[model samples]
Target: MDYANKTGGSAQKKKSFAGNKAALIFFLLTVPTLLLYIVFFLLPLGMGAYYSMTDWDGFSLSYRFVGFKNYIDILQDNRFLHSVRFTFLYATIVVVLKLFIALVLAIFLSGKLKLRGFFRSVYFFPAVLSMITVGLIFNQIFYSVFPSIGQALGIDWLSRNILGNKSTAIYGIALTNIWHGIATPMVIFIAGLASVPKDLKEASLIDGATPLQRFFSVTIPFLIPMLTVNLVMAIKGTLTVFDYIVAMTDGGPAFATESMGFLIYKHGMAEMKFGYGTAEAIYVFVMIAIISFIQIKILNRKEAGQL
Candidate 1:
């Protein structure tokens, strides 16, 4: 009995030592990543929050603490308010068009068709191009090519540059964004479609379900997770849009295209209202967090129900 107990104890010590070694290795591997995240992300975020409450001009070394005055002033700023409204409107238009068009293209491309691979490559190619380059290309198309075509066709409205008019400028930018943005979402939807259970599709067919019925009932349920991802990405990207505006409009036509991102850059960098701009940036962060949280909860609930 004593020898048996000794042997058992030796084996147990070996297992415990092996477990500890594995844990030590994991800790060592994670430490560098944790340090990097803290230094780069968390540290800057903390500094920004602190600076937002001060009255620091961008170039000034000395500044006074102003409490929430910057926040209060932002609420009363008409231009900022207008930009907020325009941004939300822009986001709505872009998100809807992107998802709808991408889904249609994805469904079409996923089917058995001649030259399917070629079409898929053509659709996804746009996603790999630089966004600013695409914007510049489309700017020329809207300004020159479109007007020429419209003149030839004798269409009065299109004969004019769409970006020159305040009413239609947002739509012009949205058209460019949709053309460039649909590629990623289309790829995601294609992947989701591929993952749908073949057996479920066959069952639906055997039960006399029409194509539309099968799509709505079988395919859509499998696509809910992908839809949520695309929605979140679309909303976040559009809300903080900057590059396209810079390339295409430069917030022109009397600041009609000024987005929150552009406003932040204008104040923080150009006008040197560092504190106020930081405050505005904080507000944007909060707004994004709240909206994204609500979206995730609703979508997760819907996904669960579908399951």
Candidate 2:
């Protein structure tokens, strides 16, 4: 009947209107975040690109366009190359150690342990603290008190300034970084572990699987997705880490502890070679992107058992 058609058409129109209204609300809600992202992230990237083509010092009024001269100089710079090498080494060591420690802690805390909440909070509390503060505190631990304690135990551990020594300075920085960054991954892994199927664990145990076997077979397989997320984060963290390095080492005892990030700061802001710094920044971005892509691909293939 025409009356039925009219009602149906009215209902369809209402649904369409609702959909449009929802879309409008969604757009409005996201507009603030989009604007903030553009202002903070995109705008800086654009300016960095422009600056990389010039010889602009930080306080300069004008700068001459140097094309890719700055980039070429960086490629040929021995110090820069050395810094890049050390950055890779630093990143690799920290990622491996931090994840291994975090995984162990997460697995332990995921079980029916006493004071689980307290332990989780204790572990995660460091992540919430300022990196500068953590660096300073850990410096004391490494320098004065730790050495004193070691001497008491006849360890002779602090024969030299760990933070100021050329040989161990990079490792020292990585240790501080691992301490600060481990909590984030631990919390993530805990969430992942908590979500693992209880039935799956029970079934595996029923089949006479030992604790280690059940973990390796059931728990770890389920953790692949979470591991992907953590690995991505750790790699990015490795490349972009700066504040703790600044507060603790300042690329100390020469350039032994110099990371790409600190070197960028030294050039762009501290040393006032803005153009060169921006070029370095872009290079770092490219490196991080490539590294992250390779890691994600490898992780995905491993999860798919294609490795």
Candidate 3:
């Protein structure tokens, strides 16, 4: 009894010491990150919120509190409203097309194939290019390459340059975004696919399950968590797209391609409507938060049900 008690006491003491060490290590790792978040993100966010309520141009020493005037003005601003609509349409198209292509590619590449690594690298290569570079390159393709190809093929519509037409300009931008953004979700889905249990796959095959059945029954359930993550990220990232729009359309051809980010840049930087732009920026944040929250909540519910 004495030996057992002594051993139990020593074990408890060691466990307590180990717990203390883990807590200390966690604090050390996280404190710097917390400090950085406060200094960089929280501070700027607070300042921007404060400025949004004022009549301060970005470069002014003296300004008065506007008392929700900026927010009210933005609601009446037609250009801002149009940009909001355009952004929603653009984000939806881009996310849907990108995710579809990524899923297809992930499924294909995860299969046994020749030069699989090479194919993956080829598909993923465009993602490494800067958004500005992608936009500029595609701009050239639309303006010069397509026109040349159209002329060669005697196609008048293709010769006319899609970006110049307000009707097709957003689609052109969406295509560009899809081309560049597919790799991210593809990689994510590949990782999820790798995590699927091989034994389950084998059992499905042994039971004479068709490929589609196995994919739907076995693979999809395992991919739910990753799908949730990718969905939220894709929505947030696509909504706030900046450099691609700047280089490709510059919200041009009568503001047809103007996104929320482009509108904020135009107002805050170009027109120097700082307070109003800050108000719009806050709206953008709120929109992202609401949409992301709803998507995550829905997806998590689905995932829980699947499990």
Candidate 4:
């Protein structure tokens, strides 16, 4: 009887020990990452929320709570509203132009052509350069080379720097963004093209479809996933574009190139209006979240419909 009882007790202990072992392994795997995320992302976000409710100029140690006054004031600020409008315009133009160019380049490079590898490398080379460096180089070209060329050719508009005009400064910045941003989507589309089934294209050709028809029907359908990814990334990156604009225009010609990001940096870091800046930052965060969510849903819905 004692041996029987001891055997049952030993079996129960083994099962309990096994459960503990599994729990420890799970905790070991997840706890470190969980703690890091809380420390780095969540904690700072909470503190930012707290700061946004106070009237804290960054230089002052003591601050008073001001409720939603900053938020109310920001809504009435014309400059901030203008920056919002400019940001949307710039992001839309850049995303559309960049994706279109990248898609074209990808299709071209995927075909049978001479020195294809070299051309692919050349196209992708700009992406590796720092945005600031790209912006500076373009700035010099716009300011000096283009003007001289235009003067020699007697072209009226190009005779002067476009960045000097408020009407054209944002367009110039958009052009710079497109120049540097195309390579990433190009690479992604190339991968998508390569993964497309050769048999399908052969079947389309057998069905007497033209090259254009095959491209639209076969290639584009296959590329939808990649397009979705690129769309979200492009929107997010273009909206937060600050460094390039700063390096190129410094939001010049009466703050014509100013994006929400630039405004946030100017108010928070440069002007020391920490509370107002934080409120603005929060507004930007919410805007980005809504935009991203909508894009993802639409793209995902399209993908589902296609399938």
Residue-level lDDT of model 4, residues 239-270, one tens digit each, is 99998888889887898888999999998899
lDDT of 3: 0.88
lDDT at position 16, candidate 1 = 58
Writing each residue's lDDT as its tens digit, candidate 3 over 105-174 gives 9999999998999999999998899999999999989999999999999999999789989989898888
Q: Give per-residue CA lDDT, model 1, range 187-254, as digits (tens).
A: 99999999999999999999999999999999998888999989999999999999999988888889
Regions of model 1 farther than 4 Å from truth: 1-25
Which pairs clash in the backbone of model 4?
Answer: none
Model 1 lDDT at residue 287: 99
Which model scores highest in lDDT? 1
- TM-score (all chains, Cα) for each model: 0.90, 0.85, 0.87, 0.91
Ranked candidates, highest TM-score first: 4, 1, 3, 2
* Backbone Cα, N, C clashes tallied per candidate: 0, 0, 0, 0
| Ten contiguous residues minimizing lDDT sum, candidate 3 | 1-10
- Of candidate 4, the 10-residue stretch with the lowest lDDT total is 1-10
